[model samples]
Target chain A: MRTTKVLIVDDEVEFASTLSERLSLRKYDAKAVYCAEDAFAIARSNPPDVVLLDLKIPGMEGTEIGKIIKQFNPAIQIILLTGESENKIISENLGKDISDYIVKPVEIGELTKKIDNAMKEKEKLDHSKGQP
Target chain B: MRIWKKLMVGFGVYVTLAAIIGIFAYVELRTITKRFTVVEVADDITNIILEVRRFEKNFLLYKDDDTFQEIKKYLAVLTDDTDKIRKEIIKEVGTDNYEMMKNAIAEYDFQINILSKNFKLQKEFISKIGVLTRSIEKNLSGDVLNSFLIVRKYEKNLMIYRDKDIYATLINTLNSPKFATAEVNRYRSLINGLFKLYREEQSSIEKIRSKARNIQTFTEDLSKRERANITTILSRSAILLLFAVLTIIILGTAVNIKIANSIATPLKQLEGITKKIATADFSKRIDVRGKDELASLGTAFNQMQDQLQNTMRFLELANEKLRESRAQLVETEKLATLGRFSAGVAHEINNPLAIINEKAGLMKDYIDMSEDFPNKEKFNVMLNAIFDSVRRCSSITHRILGFARKTDITPEAINLNSLVNEVLKFLEKEILYKSIRLELELSEALPVIKSDKIQLQQVFLNIIKNAADAVEEGGLIRISTGIKNNTTFQVSVEDNGYGIPKEMLKNIFEPFFTTKEKGKGTGLGLSISYGIIKKLGGNILVKSEQNKGTTFTVEIPV
Candidate 1:
């Protein structure tokens, strides 16, 4: 079985590192980036199968970065983590091919479930494209 | 009396006085006209007497038939005139002289008739004597002729004499004898007969003249008396006219002044009151008296004054309330600005809280994985405590963010009792720390409603916190939930604490109105809860009394 590659992007260093370690323990290849620039650079160099994006970052908007990452590789699944519970930001990026949106202080289990579902959905799409 | 009635009375008095004066003048003039008749009667008497005298003179001078006829005509006229005058005197001047004048007139008329008869007889005697003298001239001698001449001379003397002395001398001469006894006796008889007739004629003429003179005198005396009466009447009428003019002027002026004073005095008072009212002295009122229009106006003005005073006080109270509300609005504006600022800061707080939560959870997971490392129990306890502390910190931050957040919540079907329990979870620690006994009477069959869950949660949380704050240590707080009606649900939070004063009850829900000390309360809890309930098509109501308990009820549609 191929290990699922995951990228965690957040302005909160401890949150992204801890969450990445937890994902690694759960038998997945996960890495953490602290800023939008690092996230973009790492995503272009090593495009992960799934990306966890923080909606609030210092340099660039999460939606903007998500759009750029999707353009770089349409197969990359982007999920947004936000401190805001506003549905407008989520609905605005519905057509941007984002995987899902989650509010802050969300359960680790719930986030993992979303990430696993997004990877599976991408795999299914890739397999279908590979089919007739 | 009414104004018109007063004016009518005034005019009535004036008209009555004028009528009285007019009646007096008319009566006096009438009396004067009646007295004037005496002068006219006297004038007629004077004219009749003159006619009688002229006719008598003519009769004596001519001894003609025409003269006698004139004398008879004049006598008849004089008699009629005197009789008419006497009747007029009887009617006007009373009967004192009327009877005397009537007798005099009757005697005078009889005497004039006899005088006329005697004059005729004298003419006849003269004719007879002429014949006798011619017979003697033809037959007798010188002595008889002398005797006849003496008789003729006496006869001529008797015819001419009207004076009593002349008449007596003539009569004596006639009686003297100068010839034979028989002849002398015959001549004497003739002369005496003629003489007797002449004396009677003279006496009758004298009586007629004397009576005419008496009539003239009586008429003159009556004229004098009647003239005096007329004069008196005319003068009295003139005086009465003057008196009437003066009386009319005095009475009219006096009555008019009385009426004017009655009207003008009250009117001036009313005008003064009205002026005071116009100058904004609404406290002044008019004194009403009588049943007149001015009195009615005074009553109306007094009512107006009361209304004006009441309206001014009402406006002043309303203005004060408006100013208070305006101040509250300014506080609301300040709260809005504070909400925006807190929202901006909430973002910074969330990132750190999330980091802390994740790191603590990771530490707990790592400890659980290496369960047998040195001091594993203490490490697990420390890790769990850290995780719990992080959870507590996140919860507090999340609540603050929720309060400041302007996020629009999608509506969803929610159970009210469950939402109330969820909000109570935040106050559980405070309830325990304060030693308050909480009672929940949530209805199990309470209907679900479509509303914003976050806002409802905020509303319940605010009400429960307010309830908790109101209770002392070991105080009781009771929360009851039930279906209010067919399509509404209600939640009531009650606390046994020092309740709001009666005077402050109305302002309890106003923004920035709080019983808590400054810096301990932002005063936005109940106000925000009220706003939230209203936004969900609901309302928040409060009931409180001093020294008792307070209850806040929230009603929302199902």
Candidate 2:
């Protein structure tokens, strides 16, 4: 039996609140936090299945949070949210270890699809590690 | 006109006076010379007769006493006196016309002296015969008759001497041709008639001598009077000539100065001003003091200078303003483009991200439901659902990339009429929802213009979007296009929207110059469209009437 969890981080209270509402309405096991510091505190207690990162946050940058999030929970799938359509730095981070990246004003329909793809990629990697 | 002619006439009067005086002086000179000639001749004849009377008296007193000795003394004295009078007459005759008068006077003097000598001889011989008359007292009348015979014997000799002198004077009259000497010939004829009277005993020799004395006195008075006349005329001529000279000098000098001022002074003043203007010192004004053509010309010159200065200043100010306005327009354009792209960047990334988020959540649910499925194929279906989600994510990425940078550019030949219609159709739903009635008046056969299609489409989309937002439901919008120059064209979009406020009219084309509610419009729509048209060698202009309508017309080159 597999248990899936999702984490969302951003500085915008509205975007985080709205995203949490939508995720819960759609039945995803997700949690939202406003800053990277609070996110680390929650992740140590219960590591998420996947992490959604915003690069333009006020505290620690999304890439910095992403690095820390991965260190604490390497098996977790990570998806970077970039407000810019073509940010090479964000995309480069997603390619190496993150499961995916999405540019904002993210369509609600598109975000859900990206989340599913990332979850499966994470699952495949874990399964391969188990087999080895 | 009258003044100038009057001055000319005044000058002419003075010149005439000078000329008349010159002519008077010339005529007076000839009259003076003529009067002098008559007086001078009368004086000469009078002096000669007086000398002759003295000689005759001396001969009568000295005759019998000295005989030859007395005769010689009388003759010598008479000869000296005659020579002196003859020399005086010759001196008065001068060289011009008196050579003949000189010869006749010389001959007459010699003949009178010879006649006086002959009378002295006869008087001496007759006084000898008077001594013998006492013895013959009975013949005493005979003796007295002898003395009478002696006097009678001298009568022929005296007449002869006077006749010779008269004939000599007549010859001088014919030869000298002087007017006063013609009187001398008349006197000579009178002397001849006196001799004839002495022969007739109607005139004695003494009476003839007295007549001669009167002729001499008359000649002297006439000659003296003529000389006085000549002196008076000469002096008058001198005085008149001197006055004429003085008048000519004074008036001629005045005329010279007047003419010099007329010709020189005005021309010299004009030349001075011309030099100043030539050197670019146009600040000076030529004084037009005279009421003449030259003064009018001076006024014209000053007016020309004033106009030139005004024109130069206007052009300079215009040039400065043009530079300033152009610079401001360019700065405004830069800000406009930046604002449009900035807002566009955010929406571009956000839309794709939203879609990805929703799709992923659906896929996650699918994967989680595998255990509850009745068949084993549910797991397989869940895995396929994951694959579909991945493909959808890729397309989202592509769409975000296209919208973000605004670099999906493709230029093509497109008619603006058709382009405007297409944009209007695409925005129909939004237009209807906003209660704006979209109208079309596309021109047929608008020229094919070359431009970036998708960019042009975006421009039209933004303009229509604003127009739609501005108007209430059912408010009208008109889209139009027109041809120009065979290869250039224009598109115009008009709407009965809440027209741009008067205060904001000037800034309508500026970036972020909008009255739209915050967060709803970035205000880059018109600004970006402006840049688009401008970059494609075209321009955008807006005409808006407050509360009435707004129209945006874009002109593009082919």
Candidate 3:
């Protein structure tokens, strides 16, 4: 079994770092970035298996960052995170390039479960595309 | 005066003047006619005198019995005419002149009678002389016969001419010696007497002629004077009639002009003011005078204008109030739209809450996994408290998001009274805690309406809860439901509580405008309720007085 690499992108530095540390403690390779530039730099330099993106950020929107990351690596799984529980935000970005989403004050167990499912989906796509 | 009366008065004046002129003309005509009658009578008298003179001349020239009878008949006619028209003649001439003319006519008639008698006596004397002369001629010689023939010739001349010289010659011949016999002397005396009678008749005829001349002169003078009087009367009547007509015309014109001005001037003023009124300038008023119809009309017009001005002022005030309300409505709608921003604000706030939650959960995770340490239990409890506080914050944020949420309307049949009761049941604990007396004046006549049941319940709950909150303990809160109007139903929640201050009442429905103490209200309750009612096609109104009470009425269209 391979370790799942998770990238956390949020304007809240403490929330991003603590969530990344929690995910690391749960035995997953996790990293945190505070802005879109750093997020894009880390995504291109070392692509993770799944990216956790906050919908609202300081500079660029989380969805725009997600689309740019997908352009860089089409196989990288993108998951949206939002503090807003509005169904509109979730429904708008659900089926398009993004794999899954979760509301904020993220539960560690539920986030791990969504990441594992996204990694499996990525593996399924990789195997079908003849990549081992 | 009134227009009609004024006109009637003017007409009366004109008619009276016309009548006066007519009467004056009629009287003048009668006077002229009488004058003409007097002149005719005078002329008839003159003609009778002329006829008498003609008969007198005939009698004197022919000495005929028929001529004398004609003279007497004419004299009688003159006398009768003078007598018949005596008063008229006296009126025309003086009484003394009329009497003198009558006496002259009588004297002329008497003289003619005496002349006729004298002529008859003279005729008898001539016949006696003829018989004497014929006897002398038979008994005397040639010389004496010649003298007697001469005396007879002289006597015949004296009788024919009635001259004094012929009478002297006849007397000398009758007294000649050849005629000295008693018969000759007697013939001489008879001839003398015949001559004397002829002279007397001549003098009488002269006297009658002079009397006839006097009658003719007096009658001619009377006729002339009567004619002059008629002419003067005619001229005077003409002047009087002209003056009366002129006076009537001038007076009638003046009166008519005054009446016309009295009527037309006011009418003209009314027309002018009416034109101004047509243009909506009600400032000017008719200057009314008198108790005429036009004055009353002006008063009525002024009253109508006053009413119109009042109505116009009322409309302007109403429009001002409407404008203010519209502005307030726009502000409320703007604040309602602020609910949309509440979603973003909630999202932003949730980030910090999420951070706190994660940090607390991370700390709890570390504490739960780590070995026992000093005050480890306290640290775990504090971390749990932080987590609980973050949860509370998230709940608040979710509530804010609910305001912005576009929830689907699930329309259902709703009975307002049952709904109100249901809402009251939810507030039962609060009501019990406050020991507030609740009175329900629910009407069964309320009809079931189709609306969003949950939203309507939220509106009523917000309003009733606000009512309960506004009151003190043991305060009375009355909840009543009824039909507000033909198309809407109302649920009024009245409370005997400390009412909102006047300044703050206007902003009560504004977003986040709340009088509640800190941490007790989010200030979104009433605003959210307003939004819901507005979406449900209803409205909420609040009436309050400081130290009195507050009433919140929610009206929903049925």
Top model by TM-score, which number? 1
Task: Please write out the lDDT profile of model 1 over residues B1-558, one tens digit for every residue.
Answer: 789988998998799988998888788877777666657767767676677678767766666668677766766675676566565577665786777777777787687667767778877877876776676556666875676566566556655664456556655654555444554555556666787887787678788778878877877777787787788878878887898899889988899899888888888988887888788777556778888887887788788888888998899999987986676566555555666676667667777878777777787777777748888898778876766665555554554455556434469999888898899899889999999998999888876788898888878888888878887899999999998658778999999988888898887766668888754565666766765665565778889876578899998877
Question: Which scores better on DockQ, 1 or 2?
Answer: 1
The per-residue C-alpha lDDT of model 3 at residue B165 equals 86
In terms of docking quality, model 2 is incorrect
Q: B455 in model 1: Cα distance from truth in Å?
A: 5.5
lDDT of 2 at B289: 63
- Candidate 1 stretches with Cα past 4 Å from truth are A1-4, A22-28, A73-77, A91-99, A106-110, A117-132, B1-243, B254-273, B276-329, B369-400, B403-527, B530-541, B545-549, B553-558
- Flag regions of model 2 displaced more than 4 Å: A1-7, A20-31, A36-55, A59-106, A113-132, B1-558
Q: Weakest 10 consecutive residues, lDDT, candidate 1 chain B?
A: B399-408
* Interface RMSD in angstroms for candidate 1: 1.8
Model 2, residue B528: displacement in angstroms?
A: 7.9
Candidate 2 vs candidate 3, DockQ winner: 3
Q: Share of real contacts kept by model 1?
A: 0.48
lDDT of 2 by residue, B1-558 (tens): 233553565577576877688678767965665454444435434554555556555645553333434434543553444344444334555443244433334444454444455554444433533443223333335644464344334433554464555444444533443323433344334434444433433233444355444445444554675576678778878887888888777876677567556546666877887787778666777776666555676788778877866876788799887886676567555544554565466454454445455455445555565466565466556655654553454443443344335533457887776777788789868876877766788877665666788768878888888888888778988888886676557778899988998889888766557778754665566766776666565778889998898998887776
The best candidate in terms of lDDT: 3
What's the residue-level lDDT of B267 in candidate 2?
Answer: 69
Interface RMSD of each: 1.8, 5.7, 1.5
TM-scores for all candidates? 0.61, 0.42, 0.55
What's the lDDT for candidate 1? Answer: 0.77
